[model samples]
Each structure stands twice: as structure tokens, then as C-alpha cells.
Target: MKQRSSPSAMTDFYSAAALVTGGGTGIGRATSLALVREGVRSITISYATSAAEAERTAKELDSLGATVLVVRADVRSTGDITAMFDLAANKFGRLDILINNAGTTRYVDLKDLDGLTDEIWDLTLDTNLRGLFKCCRAAALMLKKSGGAIVNVASIAGLRGVGSSIAYSVSKAGVIQLTRVLAVALAPEVRVNCVVPGMVLTNWIERGGGGISTEEEAFRVAAATPLERVALAEDVADVILGLVRSKLVTGEEIVIDGGKGLTY
Candidate 1:
């Protein structure tokens, strides 16, 4: 017997019901918008800053008549992440995709590890590494029950020893490891993969590496990439979509690095 479809489910028959963390701006924002364009009717964007930016994304997506929710969240907190899952699943009925995109970066001077203190390490790991694990743990359970996809936002630093800073690089490397483990553990029910970006012009750069440097210097380093340019958020978005929908692929890191790795 053919399964009967309801009016509500029918609206999203070809659409994904998804959750995107750190969706207020930059790569997360671009990915959320792209997901909408790809026919996801129900989307919840979680962020930690700039409620206005989140609202702007919601408003823009609303024009498509898609259901959009912008929630303030700290991925580092289990309570917040858990609540988001509950709310998203409750609203959408089921979650088909989870994009783990929330993270922070810093320039680490190993020689000053003493000065760095435990607070700095905890803060960085809490958000980038530990938070990602918690989210996947929560999302994996939800996705396992229904069979879905997870796209973890990592960095090229995970693949190579190079990145904006040692901490950022190491955190992202942990993300890739987490993705691999989850991919195997999730099995046939839920697929897990990663996307790694290189030299993207986002707020993190301005705040961490490029914050004190001149814009031209930033451009010079970015242009040193093989593609002679840095990645755009949208560039990362397209690759994410491909990974999310591809059932045959899991436990891989798609690099949106403008072929920067090839330059060597």
C-alpha cells in the first residue's frame, strides 16, 4: 500500500527539515539560506551573536514562505543544545539534517602556553571541540531514529598542520576525528561528514589573526592561496549541500580551499 501523505508533510515532501548552529552570519548564514533554496521548508538557525543578523536571515528566508526560526544558543552548553533539538524536532516533527557550524578561533603562541592558562584552553575547546561532540551526540540520537545527515563545519587545518592559529587548527582537527567516529557509529541510520574551509574572510579573521593586521596584509596572505583568493561563505555552502544530500558519502572532509593545498 502506498503511504498516504498529509497536507503538512506534503509541503515538505521534497524538502529537508534541518537545524543549523551558528547561523547568524558568515558560513552558517549562507548554508541556512542555501538549504532553504534547496527546498527545506523548516529550518532553525541557532546563533550566539547579533540577533539582528539572525533576524535578517529569517526575514529573507520568510520571503520564500519557508518556516524559519532564529534562536540564541551557546553550543558549549548542553542545556541549550538539548533545548534546541527538542524545539526543532517538536516544531518540524522530524529532523532530516543537522549542520554543526558554531565555533571560535584564536592565535595560540605555544611558547606562552603558561600565560595562556587553563581558561583559554577550556574556552576554545568548550566551544569548538567539546561543543561539537555534544551536539553530535544529541543530533545523532535524533537522526538515528529517523535516518538523516550531519554536516560538521571543520577547517583545512584539520587535514594539514596549517591554519590561522594552533588552537583553531587543533580544534578543527578534533572535529574531523569526531566526524569519523560518529560516521562509523551512526552506521546506516545517520550519515556524518565534514567540510573544511581555508582563509575565509569572516569575523573570526578580523577578531583573531587579521584583527590587528592591515587589510592589505590579509589580502596578500589570502591571495597567496592557489586560487589567488579566499573562500566565500557561499562557496562553502554549495559544498555542504552536496555532502548533506549524498547518502553514499560519509566520514569525509570536503575542502573549499580554492585549491590552496595544490599550490605546494
Candidate 2:
């Protein structure tokens, strides 16, 4: 009798090397750790301004017996992106996973069109959308060689059209579409997918200038959420890991909002 092999048996990470952008903190940090736990032995994590945190995460990965490379690369800068990918290629000789998790947003009130200034809009679009595209382009050739996977971290705001600001929502929406396009563009060699998380309880809010300001406000959001809670960074990381390991799935967006979008 012939038996089917397990998906885990088919997609082994023990020999895989991965790169995670924004891998210093929040969801990026969580995803990097998850990959190490899944037996990925070599990983490169890139950070724009989270050098201290990136160092901390590198130490953690080292402690887990994974060879870790930490690079300071701002995705907005083409030179930085190119240098980061070049370093990863030099160190690992191959890359099997790419996680596009670096992004930025500002907390402008939805109706405050004037508050969504050009600077804020430009920064959000450049970092979240344009920068993500550049990372994909730089990794495309290596990913093709390794038959790798890409998991982009987007937001449910893109689908629901509500988030920190108009620019942020729009940028994430771009991420979703970009994932779909890249899935086809990289087909038969690489798979690309996206995870759309909602109301994740991370420092992102504080760092984004505090849209969900208070603990009480956060609790209210959890109460309003259909699942009676908000997502943790680890929750989103799990989804991203799943997408990375899915051998046959691509061009898909998995929403991880604890069913929050159902109400909307």
C-alpha cells in the first residue's frame, strides 16, 4: 500500500536559509524565531532603525543554534536593499525563504485628509509598497534557484479600508495585490503569498503615533472583535510560517484578525 507523505516531511527547513526584513522586533522578530524553531539553520535579519533590538534577536537566534546575520538596511533605499541581498547571498550561498515584514505607518484620523500630509503618505507608500517590491525583485533570482517561498505581512485594513491612516490602508492593499502579481511572475519556481493581520497587539501602535492609545481602548477593540480578542504577534507569525511552508499554495491572502473582518 502506498501512503501519502506528510506535508512537513515534504517541506523541510533544516537545510533552508531565510531572510526577514524588519526582523528586529514585533511580528518580524516573532517570525524569525518561528523559522529557527522549525529547524531553519541559517537566517539573515535586516533592520532599518531597530539595531539594538536586531542585535538582541540575533543573540536569541544564535542561542537556538541558528547561524544568524543581522544587517541594517532601510528598504526605502535601493542601495541598502541591494547590499542586504548581496550580503545574504554571500553568507548563505542560497536563500529558500523571504519574509517581507518591514513596513511603516502614521496615525492620522480617517477624515483628516489634510492630516494625511504628503510626507506621511510618501513615507508610508515608499516603505510599505515600493520597498517591498524592491526586496522581491532583488530576491527573485535566488528564490528561483532555490524554489523558495515569500510570505508578505499585510493588514486587514487593506481589505476593510480602515486603519491608522489612508496611506497605510492603501499601501497594504498594494501589498495584497503585489503578492498576487508576484505569485504569477515567479511561478513554477517560487511561491508568493500574504497574511493580513488585524489589530495585532504590538508596539506598532505606539511606534505609529498611537491610534489605539490606551489599554482600555485596546480592550474595547478586543471586545468588539468577533473572536473576543486581538491577534498577538506570534499568531500572525504562525500564519506567515504556514504560508512559507505550503509547497503548493501561492497568490493567496490569509486574514488573521480573529474573525474581526466578519463584523465589517
TM per prediction: 0.89, 0.93
Q: Write the per-residue lDDT of candidate 1 for residues 73-163, one digit (tens) a residue.
A: 8988999988988888888888878899998866665555566656667887899999988988888766776678899999988778776
Q: What is the C-alpha RMSD of each candidate to the true structure, in Å?
A: 4.3, 3.3
lDDT (Cα, tens digit) per residue for candidate 2, span 1-111: 995433322257998999999998999999999999999999999999989999999999999999999999999999999999999999999998999999998888899
CA lDDT scores, all candidates in order: 0.81, 0.91
- Candidate maximizing TM-score: 2
lDDT of 1 at 169: 73
Query: Lowest summed-lDDT stretch of 10 residues in model 2?
Result: 3-12
Tell me how candidate 2 scores on lDDT.
0.91
Q: Which residue runs does candidate 1 get wrong by more than 4 Å?
A: 1-13, 209-218
